[model samples]
Target: MTLSVALGPDTQESTQTGTVTSTDVLTAPDIPWNLVIWNDPVNLMSYVAYVFRSYFGYSEAKANKLMLEVHKKGRSIVAHGSKEQVEQHAVAMHGYGLWATVEKATGGGDGSGSGKGKGKRG
Candidate 1:
């Protein structure tokens, strides 16, 4: 007696055969998420910089840069990491009386619809 077997065109045969795999695993992007701080009438500029330095241990120069970005641009991405870490940063900033949020770094669109012109100080 004889037996016959057939395999599909997409099937790959190991030495043992009978294994099936249709797709390859995909990897997520390596970019980190960002924790952003937004300028508000409530928090002083110096306080924002101080929070950056104290919470993230950022250097004075870097903290100042972020502060300036907040002041001029109405928002600045103060930290980058996983979603959990970014959320932690946002919470800490809120505790410090600063307005903060998190977002995927690659998506540059600010979810806040306040508009760029809205934040500009006269």
Candidate 2:
């Protein structure tokens, strides 16, 4: 898919000590976010895998792996990028009739539930 983003010109304000304060630097757009796919009753497992393969261009093995993650763990972080990028991905996933959302990347857990027990099927 072709994506076009029009970025505005850079602007920086001078501080009292002759230091520059750029909003771009302060509000860094590079901060990462995650596209989370939630498991649900409506969609079939194979369909979820197909969406992953077709939309994200994931390999068959990778697509199945992520799909299973969603299946067993209740959710999975399928993709990560800047906030806007993941938000766009979430929108695309929604378009495909999948339950999806975006959240700031915490760099901690793998965005899965504890594997100690099986998850309830809806």
> Which of the numbered candidates is closest to the native, going by highest lDDT?
2
lDDT of 2 by residue, 1-122 (tens): 11111110110011122222232332445444667788898899999999988888777887897798788777877876567777899999999999999876543345332211122211
Compute each candidate's TM-score over C-alphas.
0.63, 0.65
The top-ranked prediction according to TM-score is 2
Clashing pairs in 2: none
Instruction: Tell me how far the alpha carbon of residue 51 in candidate 1 is from the true structure, in angstroms, after superposition.
Output: 0.7
Give one digit per residue, the lDDT tens place, for model 1 in 38-63: 77787888888888777777778878
Model 2: lDDT to the true structure: 0.63
- Model 1 residue runs over 4 Å out of place are 1-26, 29-31, 108-122
* Candidate 2: 10-residue stretch with minimal lDDT: 5-14
* Pairs in clash, predicted candidate 1: none
